[model samples]
Target: MADSGQALARRLRQLRQQQWPDTTVRQPQLARALNVSVPLISSWENESTPKVPPVSRLQTYALIFCTRRSIDGDQLVPLDETELTTEESRLRDKLLHELLDLRTVALSRTPAPGSAPANPWQFDDGNRIVIVCARLPDELLTRMPYVRPEDPDYIELYTYADLDSLFELHGHIRAFNPGGEVRRRTAKELEPDDLTSHLVLLGGVDWNDLTSDVFQVLDLPVRQVNDWGGDEGPYFSHGDRRFSPQLADGRLREDVALFYRGPNPYNARRTLTICNGMYGRGTLGVVRALTDSNFRDRNTAWLHERFGAEEAYALLSKVRVVRGQVITPDWTLDGLRLVEWPD
Candidate 1:
């Protein structure tokens, strides 16, 4: 006989704002610690229309608020459950059960709408994912007959910036996410729905407009130091440290590639991932890093180990081109990382 939604909303708000007496746990700090967006936290605490967070997210809330240890530092870091003291563990259990009971009542009264989105690039939830690729430059398009509108035998394949990167990444993504629909589009061609769905951007800021657009919105310190991943310029930079391609004898020996995975700024329910490089080879290397048969498993395992359940992170690495072949980057190996987020 109670307004369960309002009760749940009030309790969730109390856990964040009221529970922390000495240290005020701000929404932004809590969101980062919980691996969600600032807006998402607001949604849950909204007075009028509160959205029920997922059970897993509720569990994170319990872990974080159970002990002040999680917010001991300037920023909220993850609290390991195993390290929780006796009192903290008991308190966490009490908080978790209280939230769970309210969540159950709220769900029965008004069921949460829509299918929950899976992790970025994971299609197990049967959601649509859009891969946005950069278009080839005008100079290069001039040489490809299919790209010319007036050409009699035009196929339009030349419109894509990096065919190798597209081909390798598209297939790999589709195969990995059999339950979902995976679609590819040029940066300039994304539909409105595509923008809200999981977005995978390939290539660099110079060519892909979406890549540049995304970088501007994210609060990351890393950025495109140089527009073009030319022979001498660094593709991305963090502070003063630059990640540039290594070249010798006018040949690209190693190229810099960035692999970024985070909550979509457009739609927090979905994810946004960027596999990019200064050159085509570097982009291809990033794609192959997680798709390569020999190394994909190891690289993926390392990713889970390094970041855990934290959804947002970035990796800058060296993409070595050996004898014209792109060598899959082994992320677990030493000295490969140029700059990694949340270090």
Candidate 2:
């Protein structure tokens, strides 16, 4: 009989094989995308009863595969709790509850500038919700078996940075008790704004130099931008950068900007510069560039080949100019609709 971990791995592998038959993905790459070590991925593929990736990691994966038209649009296939052995079910519930609690607490404390605050678990309903997070490569999302060729849901898939944004927003909402009630803000009320926003700096600082204020604001794991949402949440690197755009000579230049991927937020601003640039000229060139092999390969290479357009666009979309004077920063250049270039 297959153990639970084996069963889960087999199911996941089957789903990938069935959905992304032509795609070439490796264990190391998947491991990076999920922010776990390559050995862990190897264990999963080899049927070891590896610990489950955190809810946050799973959520990221679910979003990727679930949005594909092929997978029936269900990011997380609801498992039958009753079907699990009594002990297994209980353990699973326990883990889920722990994660939900951690997230709740993390989001409740008032964060100081550039830091994540302590988690607050003062709400009555904090125990009721189970939000599992996961991270998956864009290739997985695009190549999944049940996904559609052109799906809007897939287009809106979130990245580790985006998740960080949401996590920060959650913290802000928790601080305001927006409704003046304990932990009572709706999702809408948790939207990100300047006062409640955080800037994730990426490089050149010792982990020891990180301020409590930065930790409280981002609510991220110490020195890491990507973190899982469970008892055994794994930390992943989101290399130094954010997002930005530029326009010149009737061309739109898009970039995946960052500073550095490290354990400290103090250097986030230093490494934060436009890193990846996407250029577009005419409509045809822009469309082609969007799906160009060179562009995809180059961009994926920059991300250590663990992500694709799904993740790329998600990061690109979140870019907001915190403080700067740009001639054309709003996706348009001199009153012209900028086009997306290939590489």
Candidate 3:
């Protein structure tokens, strides 16, 4: 007798054949239709005992299949409740526990930080506050206040001031140097405009050796959220631009040079190095050489032709080279210059 998995697989194949009698359904097309990965469908086809999909995903698959069949306006018709219950029982008893065990083992293999106390927001007293804009990590989420994506409280704030300050605080929390100075300057800049508004710091900060000066410098009265702990949603990579740190072997250094050189090198050489020399080291020099005024201007036309303004902006933000120093453009460049060779 064929096992349940084989039966399910045969049934699925039959359903597909009945639905699309003339056409051969490809794995990718089926995966898309089912809202699942191609590997999953492949597994179902090959495995002796195929794992049943989660209830939510199964519902989606049923809906998609039903819609394709043009039955009941996008609703799955003729679903046997008894069959579903039996499958669900098998999945819960046989598959779920095993899958969960594997997942637990995988999670356990990774290094994790100390657990925060339950209810991190209990410290918030409507005084100093930090609002987090990024997704929170699961480990950190247990400590904080987080409304779900569909919740009415879910709000995405992206004003320059909010983002700038949030980014600055994020730097402080992550010990991001450039972000620290940016945070300080941001606090100073915003203080005058919003004096009455209590300082609300969002995102994590390094608590070790943290002094009142750090808080005072940023004008204290801050609220903080460390979403790195995982209370937030998924991490989204919105831009196509990629960033690679310069490795000591100098191969990565050459990579940076190639990016700057592009199609024409000699004609595009107007360079303005923006470095927090104390923090950024020599990476800014590399970026300046690559994105100098001449290169920027030339690239502008190319970028316009290739991508829209929003895309360009996203690319630029993603191209950022983060460093340890906290120097600004107004400061002298000598501090940040790498070893100078004899001219």
Please report, in order, the local distance difference test score of every candidate based on alpha carbons: 0.79, 0.31, 0.31
Task: Tell me how candidate 1 scores on lDDT.
Answer: 0.79
Query: Model 2 segments beyond 4 Å from truth?
Result: 67-343
For each of the candidates, give the backbone clash count: 0, 52, 30
Per-residue lDDT of model 1, residues 1-343, tens digit only: 2387778889988888888677678898888888889999999888688887766677788888888788766788757888999999899878876775576556556633542222234565578889899888788877766677787887766799878888887887787788789898998888989999988999888889999999899987587767444555665778887777877888999998989988989999888899988888999998888777666644664565567567799999999998878889977554687887778
Candidate maximizing TM-score? 1
Model 1 stretches astray by more than 4 angstroms: 1-120, 227-232
Report the number of the highest-lDDT candidate. 1
Q: Give per-residue lDDT, candidate 3, residue 209.
A: 15
**What tens-digit string does per-residue lDDT give for candidate 2 at 71-181?**
223222433334455655455544333333332232223233543222111122222211111233456555554345355544232422124323533343354333332
Candidate 3's error at 136, in angstroms? 52
The Cα error of candidate 1 at residue 272, in Å, is 0.3
The TM-score between candidate 2 and the true structure equals 0.21
How would you order the candidates by lDDT, starting with the best?
1, 2, 3
- Show the lowest summed lDDT stretch of 10 residues, model 3: 257-266
Q: Which residue pairs does candidate 1 place in steric collision?
A: none
- How many angstroms is residue 268 displaced in model 2 relative to the true structure, after the best TM-score fit? 46
